[model samples]
Target: MKISELYVYPIKSLRPTKITEGKLTKLGFRYDRRFMLLKVIPGENENGSGPTLKNMHIPEYPEMGLFQTEIEEAKGESEGDTSRLIVTYNPPSSSDTKDNTESSDSEDSQARRLEIPLEPETATLKPFTVTMHSSPTTGYDMGSRYNDWFSACFGYPVVLAYLGTNTRSVLGTLAPAKRNNESWWRIWKQELVLPSNGHGNKMLNQWLVPFSLGYLVLNAVSWCHGRIENGTSSPAVAIGVTALALTVLWTVVNILVNRRHEARIGFADCAPFLVISQTSVDDVSGRLDGGVEVDLTKFRPNVVVEGAEVAFEEDFWAELAVGSNGNAGAGKDSKVKLLLTGNCVRCQSLNVDFSTGKMGTGEAGSVLKKLMKDRRVDRGARFSPVFGRYSFLGGEGIGERIRVGDEVVVLRKGEEYTVTGKSASEAWNVILTTGY
Candidate 1:
């Protein structure tokens, strides 16, 4: 198997920016969701009276899928630390009514392009806070011009926010639990922080919560040195050597597992990257009304693989490695390593048509129902049908570029490995032990 397609979404919930060669970062694919839209909750604020912000992703507003965005990075660094992001709003017009296609000459003409600075000056802007999943992080208000642009487009009181800092950290459950109890739980120091997307299951949250006693005691020494949050009593747990070691191990595993992808993420729902087999998509499409032709982009995967022998065959891949140009590298430069985190559970977002911005298409639950006939692997999300595996790129090839046609190698196969969601620590062990 090989990578058949690669994509990046510069902004969350908007259109995908397709690219053959992609660079991986600690947060995610470079510029993939560094910016996001938020629904301005009407209330009182610092400006005497203003609105608070809450995340409005594809879940809350499907119309966001209608907007297309392109990032034009400056050719040289001397031009200043900024890039131009062009956003094109695809409004529903009589011309778009004829077909369900995403782009056309008519729509292109009608599409309004809004050019915004990549690195906007936040010196005069107020520090706006928003919650992603459930993690609270601060973002700079992009001014009224941006707010007006998105508000007019999405037909709501929306504000654009940029990730000024890597505020929110990846969930402990998504990545492996840190070893030797070094308090590797949070990246941000907030009073009452929660895991993103309500991943706080009763079992896992007990050990992973930022303020839990187990965490406090493990790094008691660091907290005593005055590492507390906002100068509050809650001290910041100093990251330990064990935590760094685990990270290094995770990176090494990612490099050897699949050299095509490295460990990096930026605001993606679950993991840094998601991979789906093209054959699986073909299977789902074949069953959908025979001629409806549901595009794979609806699934919003970073990487899509073609030529799998059977549908959902990717489930057995524990540690996957992919080589460039069908040529395998000897030490580490040859391939990209990817560690299978868990199965991606589908949500209502899949039902919305990316091209039409309409919901409840005939193909919405049709493919899911067919997949549920046998392909349910995640016991925690048993009611949901899974179509792709959410994975993390290992650290060794952190910024390596991988493209379509990279040869895929399944370095480890774990037929018995499954994400039970009963406990993250237990699940991590299962993923670690079942692989080669």
Candidate 2:
């Protein structure tokens, strides 16, 4: 198959920016999901009166899709000159509105533009923590000025946060567990230290196992002494021993199941890359009433390939090599190789009609409903219909550049290859045996 399109979302849940070519980084495209918007409760604070920050998305705020983003390179000839991300607010005209009402004249008087430094001065920005899908990572607050812009657009309190130099790990269970020739024991040992880039807090993650093991040993010794001296086990001691044993067991299991998947992500929801076949989009469109052609942008794929002979054939692709030649045996020499980690789960965001800033009631809005009828195929995320495949950049292609029209080679395919939320060992084995 050949790649037909590529896209990146600088800010999570906002409009996607299509690119003719993109650089592969550990965290997807270079600028993909490097910033995000967080909803702030008016009277809330971190002291626990209420939530201080919450994630915003198109499902809750359909107008988010109307916010267009453009990247402008710096023109100044100075070392301090930096590119800027320009965001503009453009509401639909009266004819495009679902309610047939014109946008407010005042709101439309001028298209408001918010300019943000593509690479902000993180040293001066305040550190912030943002969580998604229970995975928390560090972010830098863009201060009151940027917050005010988003807050005014939504008519509520919100804050814009930059990912800065920090990196978030892929959901542990979804990450690949093994390297090409590494053993499980080696991976377990490596897990004791920080995986991915060293941006993760060492005190919080790296030392967890040592402290837990120490505590378990101390508790065991105390319980043994108490039993020997008293010649009887007290109820409290018995309970303590049971709890400690369970804790240690859980810790070890977590190290095995979660820690080995060391893939890092930025603000993107899951893997670094998401790919979909154009034929699959066409198939979904054909199923829609009146054959309404669904916009490929709605799926939000980082890579779109067009030469698949069958719809949904990507479901069987365990690994892919993207380069000038479509050869599965290209091995590490391939410029842009990808590991297909899992299926991309769908959400109600697909029903959003950007033109009207509301969920469409016609064929477009029913995309999710149609897929749910037969596309609930992934056992791991069964409730959500599968659309695209989530992927990670292969070790060989980390710094490579991938462009549109590149040949995509299916390196491996099998029925047992899909991620089912079980242990990652099976997936790792597939990667190793297939020479990924």
Give the range where candidate 2 is weakest over 10 consecutive residues by summed lDDT.
427-436
Candidate 2 overall lDDT versus native: 0.75
TM-score of 2: 0.74
Superposed by TM-score, candidate 1 places the C-alpha of residue 162 at a distance from the truth, in angstroms, of 0.5
Instruction: Give model 1's TM-score versus the native structure.
Output: 0.70
lDDT of 2 by residue, 173-278 (tens): 6665532345666555655554333356757677777677668767767776677578687767766776777688768766664544467888877678889999
Candidate with maximal TM-score: 2
Give per-model TM-scores: 0.70, 0.74
lDDT of 2 at 163: 98
**Whole-model Cα lDDT of every candidate shown, in order:** 0.64, 0.75
Among the numbered candidates, top lDDT falls to 2
**Model 2 spans with C-alpha error above 4 angstroms:** 46-51, 74-81, 95-111, 178-261, 324-332, 422-436
- The 10-residue segment of model 1 with minimum total lDDT is 427-436
- Candidate 1, residues 1-436, lDDT tens digits: the string is 8889988877778888787878766555677777788887788766766666666667457787789888777877643366778889887666535745678776656546788777667687778666554445677778898889789877778878877654564443565322112242222221123323234474454445444634644555454445444354443233454456446754754444332222223455446777889998887877777587667877888889887899888877767787766455322344367777677666666677666676655666365466667666677656656678777765444566778888777777666635645544333232221110
